[model samples]
Target: MELWFTEEHTKDVRFTIRVDEQIESVQSDFQKIDVFQTPEFGKVLVIDGYIMLTEKDEFVYHEMITHVPMSVNPNIKKILVIGAGDGGTVRELTRYNTVERIDMVEIDKMVVDVCVDHIPQTACKLSHEKVNLYFEDGLKFVKTKENEYDLIIVDSTDPVGPGMELFTVDFYENCFKALKEDGILVNQHESPYYAREAAAMQRAHEKIKKVFPVAKVYQAHIPTYGSGHWLFGFASKKYDPINHMDEEAWNKLLIKTKYYNSALHKGAFALPNYVLEMLEQNI
Candidate 1:
């Protein structure tokens, strides 16, 4: 018998990966966490049967989320990250010497523990000096903050279970209030390839647009995610991701990346016509 891990992308579509063995599986207070070893993707982290990250292509999602805002405003020193329990986001942000403090709010502590025990590659930087971990609700965490952080990254899961509130208008409003003047907000916007997912993507964009002065969507290709095409939300009070990008200064940092660069940073925001129409028409 062959061991495999399968995820249902939709009612009719499913993705399966050949698994060598199950390394760990523990039921956390929030959700079920599992780690598996695979030939194609190496070590994989699963939350509630959803693929969170894999050692093989984790760089693409983590790097794009961190570098896109960092390149636009290299002076950003204080960052507030929500729901990034895997520590991949912090790992990339800690690479910047200029980033002084990172306050990460995660609702599930077991998710962090499981990742640290099984996938040390991404979880290594969770203990860095600049990082401060707070295991609480991200929605409530931002509510207590007011114009403090220079950047805020909403590295949340899909709009369900523990992450559903992160997509609401109230949460986005609190996020806007928690950022300093000219601060930036980036989030894991859902994919636009499927009907259900696309509806959620459009809803999130609409809510952010109501709160922030500038709101835009960007794209990235991550194979494990549904449809292999994912989107991210970029909202800011003052700076424009394209016009204000400090490409020269960012390049000077000499930060080596596997999937992100200055060129791709500018091109990611250039969405396809259908996606553009969906955003404009609210379809």
Candidate 2:
């Protein structure tokens, strides 16, 4: 027997999920993480009631999330990842030869331990020599460091539980201070159709706009996340997402991708009228 999850992303598209018996399940005092065997997405990790990652669709999120900034800033060396307990972001970040070190700050040690032990499909990157792991709050760890990183990627879980604080204005300011003048920050901004989630994204974007000279919202479509369409918040000081893409670098470094390409890179930034309206009206 199998199960499925589906929703219409747009008038032209519908996202679907089909799953078999669970491959793995972990319940902590704070949350429950489940990995299920899925036909379309291979193995999917669900934390609490939210879809965290799917082996099949993971590349779309991880690659787009990691590559967009790196493609813009070529010299990024010291990378900081917040709340990516499973190491998928680190895995993608390592693909960049310029990334010499990765400091992954995660709030839950249990999540790290569980992923390292059971979710190798997504957690395999932690074993790499370049990654330095820390079990601390993403907000607090970022405060002590100032102008130290070239890139910071926040692979935070959906805003809930310990992940709640990572979405605040204070956290964005701390990240700005912790980043080098040229450093860039990118984080999951969640879905657009769900009003509550959309407002959260807008609020976060507004805060980032206040502190960072360059703050933009880009989106991707993932089957597991609500409404399939998802958005990411980008904040930077010296790099412009619109002006910074190096065609030679992106095309050369291109990996096998089911979604996300140089074309989508440009297309993704072409926000629909409503998004533009939000970006403008709110500012």
Question: Pick by lDDT: which candidate is best?
Answer: 1
List RMSD in Å for every model shown. 0.8, 3.2
Give stretches of model 1 more than 4 Å off. none
Candidate 2: stretches off by over 4 Å: 1-18, 254-256
lDDT of all predictions, in order shown? 0.95, 0.80
Q: In model 2, how large is the Cα lDDT of residue 210? A: 90
lDDT of 1 by residue, 1-283 (tens): 6999999899899999999999999998888889999999999999899999999999999999999999999999999999999999999999999999999999999999998888999999999999999999999999999999999999998998898999999999999999999899999999999887899999999999999999999999999998999999999999999999999999999999999999999999999999998887754
Q: Taking the tens digit of each residue's C-alpha lDDT, what string does model 2 give over 132-244?
A: 99988789999999989998898887677988898888998899999998889998887767766777677777788998998888988876777777898778987888688
- Each prediction's TM-score against the native? 0.99, 0.90
Best by TM-score: 1
Model 2 RMSD, rounded to 1 decimal: 3.2
lDDT of residue 139 for candidate 1: 91
